[model samples]
Target: MTAEQINDKIELCESAMDLILSEGSFTIAQLSEATGKTASQIYSLFPNKKAITEYYYPSLVIRYSAMIGEIEDFESYTISEKLSNFIFTTFDMMEDRREFVEDTFEKMVFKKGCNSEFHQEMTALFKHFFTTDGRIAVSAGFVMKDYFYEFIAREYLDIVKFWLNDDSDGKERSFALTDKLTGFVEEVVYNKVIDKGFDLAKYLISHAGLAKNIPLFGEWITSWFNDNEEENKDE
Candidate 1:
């Protein structure tokens, strides 16, 4: 599409999003009436209400990224602080559209093939912070980096869901919860890479209840020991 076409599509989607917020729902005909555009024109851009709702995800991500990117000291903030800022900024942006978000979340989030794009967008956002000082890179290499990103993406959505239902004073509880979760992830990665005092694999196995259900657990443990014995012989 040409630049002008792209701009028009964005404007239409923004208008539709506003309508969704104001009315708690919207149809293409309503959007056409509101925007002075034909129903066919709106349909050409978004085939259904769900598509318009899904448009908010990428649009909001871009807006949030640009907003945070403009902060002069954003890069200087620690990972947890950056995360807190992201969560707060996102909530601020969505404050006016809370109902629309909650209504469309089930329809858009975790759908078979829909989440991966959003996940990638979030991963790219977090990777900027994670790679700032090469902290995440220390423990997360080629094999583990994708998993780390996926975990952060999934946790971010989970936290947003929790935040929507939070009713504590000034929503301070959500901020505190986000801080704890980010801190825990940092500590786990730090111990896994820097301290090495805790064995994450062993901890996972121990906490994985119903050993019989996980047939690979025994084979994994045996292989771990065999590898250790081989290393000992090499030493």
Candidate 2:
């Protein structure tokens, strides 16, 4: 990429954020001002504000994934702590770009549910967490599916909404509640399965206990039970 291309990209993003927050729309002139770049330079990088927004979603996903990857790397940290810290770090990353992050998160969580790209990424991460640190937990018997997302969203909706509204409280409640619920899940998953060594997976497989229709917009919802031998490998 040209130096102007490389340089203006960040500015375009910052400007888009500032304009959206200050005014409800992101414009070329606003982005140019925010990034201290000439209009011609910006035009060369981005055709228009809509292009910036389009790029923002995928870029946001990549950035968010990296943040979650950090939480995943902390082997000593419990799942609950990692989750809490993840939420905190996430908000921090979106400090000035709060509106976009909140809107994207809410849309993925409640509106479109898991149909959105963000939710798909999150579900993949959760699946990875289970196969890794949570492997024993899963093998032992913690087979709850859809309820997990519902539980998390329900647990933090108000705090998240409040934080989006003002963010003056520094997201204290959101942090605390996320930590608490994650702890609860950790206990339910770890203590119940790892410590006790319950054969819940067997029951789940033999009986299809965790079966439910996953919400797919136009596609058939499928369940990923431990017994599905075909789904044992990566997709």
Candidate 3:
């Protein structure tokens, strides 16, 4: 495709994502109609629905992050509350379109050998958040390390997945779980590390090493618990 055509198609795909967020779902035919192109044209650009999903996935995040930034600046909001609100509100805003996000998360981020610009962006985003003034107080002797930020980003994906699958208590279970985990980490940082004379940055980096992989481990344990619960029901 010509560069202009490719750009146009990208815009069309973005528009499709917007519609899906607003109206639940849209077919290639619908996208084509909206873009004043033929269905074949849409397919030529995206190849298939999965390609569309992949294209739309990062775009969705970029948009959501912009929206989150707007509400994130109120003095009344605690950092933890701000972060949680961003997560939940973005999820709610996603509505039925979250399947795409979940799919992208699993296939692109979590799966082995699935690394890309997307994964790096996520890691960097977390690192940036943690090193900033609102995050942890930087010291003159402190080195800007990214270890914990990477871990948090990886864990955040797992948390989102947990929230998505949880139908219990209107997904309050997932929300509560995330809040507890965040607070636990915060406490660990403040009392156990900061107040206790540990190197706070280094401690966070160490915690990152342990916590980043815990999501995958947590998944296994959750599965085991679910299986045992089912076995009990059967017996």
- Candidate 2, residues 1-235, lDDT tens digits: the string is 7655544575577668667877888667667667787888777777776667645543443565555555545756666765566566556766657667666656534466545444555555554555556434654333646556544544444445555666447667656666677787777767643333224333433555332322341122123333344545542
Clashes in each model (backbone N, CA, C under 3 Å)? 0, 0, 0
lDDT of 1 by residue, 54-130 (tens): 77776666667868758997777767777778777888867777777777665576453225556677778877777
- Highest lDDT: give the candidate number: 1
lDDT of 3 by residue, 21-128 (tens): 677778876877777888777776777866675665444445555565576454355446645665676567555567556545667656632254444665665454
The lDDT of each candidate is 0.69, 0.56, 0.59
- Which stretch of 10 consecutive residues in model 3 shows the poorest summed lDDT? 135-144
Which stretches of candidate 1 lie above 4 Å from their native place? 1-10, 27-47, 110-116, 135-137, 140-144, 189-235
Query: How high a TM-score does candidate 3 get?
Result: 0.58
Q: What TM-scores do the predictions have?
A: 0.68, 0.55, 0.58
Q: If both were scored by lDDT, which would come out higher, candidate 1 or candidate 3?
A: 1
Score candidate 1 by TM-score against the native: 0.68
